[model samples]
Target: MSLSVARRTVTTPILLGLLLVAFALLALVVGSKPFNQTIIDIFLKVIFVVGLWVFIGNSGVISFGHTAFACLGGYIAAWTTIKPMLKGTAMPGLPDWLMGMEIPFWASAVLAAGWAALWALIFGAVLMRLSGIAASIATFAMLAMVNSIYSNWESVTAATSSVVGIPIVRSIWPYLIAALIAVFAAWAYGISRHGLALRAARDEPTAAAASGIDIPRARLIAFVISGAIMGMGGALYAHSIGIVTPDTFYLGLAFITLSMLVVGGMGSLSGAVLGVLILSSLIQILRWLEAGIEIGTTTFALPGGVQEIALGAVMILILMFRPAGIMGNRDLSLPRGAASDSQGQTGPKT
Candidate 1:
C-alpha cells in the first residue's frame, strides 16, 4: 500500500477504538432521569442493529418487512407472560399451552425468537426468489400484508387495541447480556461459511450460482436469522414497555432500522450499530427540539417532517460521499481492510 493508504489503515483501528469507548460511555449515560434506562436502551439498539446487519449487510439486500417477526415475538412473549387465566386482550387465539402456562421470562423470550424464525422459514420461500429492488418491494408488500393482519387480528392480538400485564423485567443488565450475545452472533455470522456463501452471492450472483451456491437458500438462512434476532428484540421491547399495540409493529420501526443500517454503512455491521446509536440519540434530540419550540406556559406546535427531512438528507449525503457507509464494511473490532502488496505499495484508487 502507498504511504497514504497505509496511514489510513493504521488510523482506522485507532479511531474505532476511541469511538467504541465513547459509545460505551454514552450507553451508560444518555438519560437525564438517571433511572439507568439509557444503558438498557443502548442494549436494545445494539440488538436491533445487529439483527438487521445479519440480513442486509451480508446479503446486500433490504427487507422492509422484518417488523412482522418483531411483532410475532412481541405477541409470543406477551401471551406467555400475561396470565392466561385472565386472558386480557392479548391474543385471543393464544395456544392452549400458553394459556396459564406461566413460563419464565428468559424461556418465553427464547421461544419468541424461535417462533420468529419459524415465521421466516415459511415466508422466506416466497420472498427470497426476488432480489435487489424487486426483493425490497416484495418484502415491503409483505409488511403491509402483515400489518393488515395485526391491525385487525385482535382475537389473536386484541385487534388494534393495546395489551398490558407483561411483566417489565428487562433492565440494563439484561440488555447488556442480550447485547453481548447479539454482538457475538453477528460477528460469528460475518465469518461463517453461510456468511461467506451469502457474501459470494451478493457480490456476484451469477458466479456464485455457477459454483453451485443456492442464492435463495443463503438469503433465506440470513432471513431466518434476522427474524429470530428481531423476535428476541421485540420480546425485549414488549417487556420493556409492559404493553404493546399493532402500531408498534409497523411504520416507524422498519424505517428507523433501515436508516440505521444505511447511515452507519449498509456494507458494515459496525455501521449498523453506530447508525442505531446515532439515530436513537437523534430522536431524543428531535424531541428536545420540539420541546424547545414549545413556550414555557403554552405548547407551540413542533414542526412536522423534521425526522424524514433529516434522515433523507443524511442518506443522500452518505450516498454521495462515503458510499460504503460510515465505517465502510469494517468495525471497531475485527476490521477487514482492503488487501495490500508485500511492499505495501498502494494501487490506484478504484
Candidate 2:
C-alpha cells in the first residue's frame, strides 16, 4: 500500500476509538449513575450495530437474524457465569457438567463468540446459497426459529421467564474496550482481501462471479465474522443489565440495531458508529423529557410513547433526505488536501 493508504488504514480506527473514549470520559465527568449506565448502553449498541454493518453493509444483504446470534450469546453468559446453585434452580435441564461450571464474565463473552460463530457457520452453510430477498427471509426464519425454541425450551432456557444472577458490569472501561475491539475488527475486515472481495461481489455479482469469485463463500465469511461480533455484544449486554431473557434479543433489538445501521448509511463504518451515538443521545433526551424536564417554573413532558414515535420519524426523515446515510458510502477520513499518493489516491473507498 502507498504511504497515504497505510495512514488512512490506521487513522479510521484511531478516530473511531477516540470518539468512544470521549463518550466514556463524558459519562465519568457527569458522575451520575444513570448517565453512566446510558453510556454503557451506547457502547453496547455500537458493538451490535457495527457487527451488523460488517455483513449487511459489505454484502448488500439485509439480515433480520443477526440478533439470534446475540440471543445465543446472552444465554451462554447465563449458563457460564451464574452460580452453580442458581443455575440448578433456574435451569434444571442443563447437563451436570454445565450446571457445575461457572466462569468469569470475560470468559463467558469469549465462549459466547465462539458458540455463536459455530451456529452461524452451520446456518450460513444452507442460507448463504440464496441471495437477495430469499436470503433475507431465510435469515428472518432463523431468528423466529431461535426465538421460538428459546421461548419454549423450559428445561434449558427457563422458557420465557428472565434468567437472573448474571454478573453486572457497571464499569464503563470494559465496555469501552469491547467497543474498540469491535470497531477495529470491523475496520480490519473491511480492508482485508476477503472484505474487498465480498464488497465486489455485492456491487457486481455477475462480474465478480465471471472473474472467479466464490460469491457465497465471500458472503459466508462476512456472516461468520459478523455473528461472532454480535455474540460478544450480546454477552456484554447481559452483564450490563444483570439479566437475560429470550425476548431481550428478539425483534426489538434486531430492529433497533438494524435501524442504526440503516440510518447511519449501511455502507459506511463511520455511519454505524455515528448512528449509535446520535440515536442513543436522542433516546436519552427523550427519556428525560418523558420524566418531565423542568423548564424554569413549569414541568414539561412528552407522552410516554413519544420516544418510539420520534425515533420512527427521525428514521423516515433520514431515509427521505439522506438515503445513503450521514456519511454516505465514504468513510471518515482526513481532508482530501491533507494527503495524496502519486496517483492522487488517498485510500480505499471504505
Candidate lDDT scores, in order, read: 0.74, 0.90
The residue-by-residue lDDT of candidate 2 on 285-347, one tens digit each, is 999999998889999999999999999999999999999887767667657775322111123
lDDT over C-alpha atoms for residue 86 of model 2: 96
With a 3 Å backbone cut-off (N, CA, C), the pairs that clash in candidate 2 are: none
- Which residue pairs come into collision in candidate 1? 1-344, 1-345, 1-346, 2-346, 91-156, 92-155, 154-158, 154-159, 265-325
Give, for candidate 2, the lowest lDDT window spanning 10 residues: 339-348
Runs with alpha carbons beyond 4 Å of true place in candidate 2: 1-6, 336-350
Over the full model, what C-alpha lDDT does candidate 2 score relative to the true structure? Answer: 0.90
Residue 131 local lDDT, model 2 = 96
Q: Report the number of clashing residue pairs per model.
A: 9, 0
TM for candidate 2 is 0.95
